[model samples]
Target: MRFDELDSKMRIYETAADYCVLPGMYMVARLDGRSFTRLTKDVCQFEAPFDTGFRDLMAETAENLMTCGFRVWYAYSESDEISLLFDRDEQLFGRKLRKYNSTLAAEASAKFSLLLGHVATFDCRISQLPSENLVVDYFRWRNEDAARNALNAYCYWTLRKTGLDEQQATSRTCGLSVSQKNQLLYEHGLNFNDVPAWQKRGIGLYWEEIEKNAQNPLTGESVMARRRRIKRNFDLPMKDQYDGFIQSFFTRSPSRGIS
Candidate 1:
């Protein structure tokens, strides 16, 4: 067989099962840490329930993903998960699902592992939302999840500190309602409402315009110029307010697709 004919015959096997995101649909890539519970608790030994160092690592990894060659409009991170919202018009790799899944997972895993000095891994998947409202709901879902996880974690760790083993703590919190969990924390003198907003609501990353001082080469004069930067929001709104916040991004002018 000719070289071109042989190459074409083999390539079909690789591309036969490939799927792509359709045009006009919103794409959101969610990357989750693999085996992170053991990685953080047993190997890294990070502070239980929540730790600032681990939080920072997650935030940094999310930010890195935003600038790593994709038109990511927003990023949200909580616990060991990161969610990236891409611009609606994004057509990279002709919207290939496997390309996105593999690249993002590799990028996140590589960035996080380098930062932590350990071999951490992330698995990625893309959610194709058909409407803007669905996109808003998607983020709202994750936002509320953060709150639930935070409350449960605080309650679980508190019980653990009070001599409850893992099984005992999980058993105690299994059937507790939201109010009941809050009461549990109150009984331990830790107010769930007083926890850091970032822990409960997750962190958001988006681009913002800021002015910077620059020097004019011709006249040696200083001038203010505007530039876009990734702004980190540790304090995010909740419920209806959060829905409005995500909706607002859709109405903005098309992004320049910068890193």
Candidate 2:
């Protein structure tokens, strides 16, 4: 057949069949010490989320998940939880949902249970977003909500710890908006300069470096595509996609400061 005829036939075949690809909404929940409020204040010297050290810890955790087999996009709720966007079609990932959820939950429980010296557990769920715009807005909403809630909780908790009555503490916390909480972080010698770059880019700010050096742990092949990196992890049990898995920590690049 002529080249043009062959191309025309191929297009018709492509249109008649369904294909699977990555890039969809995923939620990554991390179960760490439930008392992160006190633990964070003790370890980092300030409230959670606003505390740079705590944020760094969360970043490392996200990196860990990315390296394992997930496309982790953003960390949310100021606790140990995160929200991720996967790189596989909904149907493909759905096939392994049970194993994915259980393994992640177990990994989190083991890691944080030891890290925090307390019992911790994680649970995850996946959702497919029909469009890219919704994906971006979803993350923005989750992160902002996490920030606001964490700040308010800390404000009330801090006041109560200082012996303020319940009503007084609640009333006092009402005035501490997210901006004011950020200011307090600054006053306490903490930096709020960067709002997680992972949240913005769906990967860490150092993604370029990661792309440069990351190799598939299972196949020893270089996998440079972000979407493929996410798929490698998702298809891990299948063993066929191992060549595309990429490590999360290639190099640490400074983030571009808040959005």
Candidate 3:
């Protein structure tokens, strides 16, 4: 057998099962911390329920993903998870799902470990959206989840601070409705609504264009150039208000996608 024939045969085996995302559909790569329960509470000993340090680490990791590769239009992070919305026409790795998933997980794991001063792992998955409406709904769903998680965390930590064991705290919050959880916080002199929006709604990162004036070394002439950079938004809105933000991003960029 010839060497070229053998090499071609081996390459087919590796790529035979590779799956690629639809070219015209929007791609969302969501990365979640693996076994974060043990990592946060047992290993790192983050503040009960929520900690600023851990939150900052997640935010920084999200920022790194935003700038890593692919033109991510929006990045959202909450709890131990981050979701990155890639451009509609992204062709990196030929839109290979395996490439996007493994690379993002690797990047997130590396960045998070460096930020936390300890080893951490993130597992990533890709979501394909057929239209813009699904994209809007997807983020709204995550935002609502952030709200629920925030309420439960505060309630659980308060119970723990008041001497309830882990099992008891879990039992106490189990089956509790949203209003019930808010009331539980209020009874303890904590206002759920007063909690920081970022904690409840998650953090968002996207690109923003700014004008930079540059002087040509040869001509010594001042000229304006448009520069694009990542911008983090911690004060994200909820419900219908957030929908507007999604719509704005979709329209803000010049015809980056088809109709």
Candidate 4:
């Protein structure tokens, strides 16, 4: 057969996609901390309670979670709490929320329990929410709670280090808020006031800004150009802004379907 004839019959482009598709806008994950704290405190007798080593451990743990295949960002709260953000568009992520949660929790429990020689125990819960405004607000509220708890925990640990018993530690730190935490730290020569505020938590900015600078998700024109003649404003990125949109689906469990 001639090369040209063979090439014509091969249908080389039939299986190819015309264009690339980007993934989801964002991914949000939260973990419960009450059990984590109890476990850590029981196991480690470090003077500051949640010392640098513990924090590093949590960071490593977050890195492990990232192995599930998403862009990951994490923050710690109250010595034992954590919040995770994942890229929403990764493959199988939407369907794997439960699997991810259960797997993370189980791994934490087993690893911590074993490493700490039964002195500590961990029980955890995980959840994912849409990255819309309402969900952002929810994340803010949750992180704020974590921040407040962190201040309290630090205060209690400080008092305990200064020779107060557990009861006294809790009592002395009662009613302390983030502002108070700053003042207390300032009194002791520390510069920064508090951890990042809960309101400041999560993915810092929205993708709308990025879309504003680039072509529209649907029409593929400058956003301002379209706005000049008609009053049409579309802020969200094109659904397939990234090639891995399937990961966002992991937030939704198969049993629960869409919520």
Residue-wise lDDT of candidate 1 within 125-208, one digit each (tens)? 999999989999999999999999999999999999999999999999999999999999999999888899999999999988
Q: In model 1, what are the clashing residue pairs, if there are any?
A: none
RMSD of each: 1.6, 14.6, 2.0, 15.7
What does candidate 2's lDDT look like per residue over 99-122, in tens digits? 566666666556655655555456
Candidate 4 versus the native: TM-score?
A: 0.50
My TM-score estimates for the predictions, one after another, are 0.96, 0.49, 0.95, 0.50
Q: lDDT per residue, candidate 3, 1-259, as tens digits?
A: 8999999999999999899997689998889999999999999899867788888899899989877877788899999999988888889899999999999999999999998889999999999999999999999999999998888999999999999998999999999998999899999999988898888999998888889999878899999878887787889988999998887778775765211
Worst 10 residues of 4 by lDDT: 228-237
Show where candidate 3 strays beyond 4 Å.
Answer: 257-259
What would the TM-score be for candidate 2 when compared with the true structure?
0.49
Per-candidate Cα lDDT values, in order, are: 0.93, 0.47, 0.89, 0.46
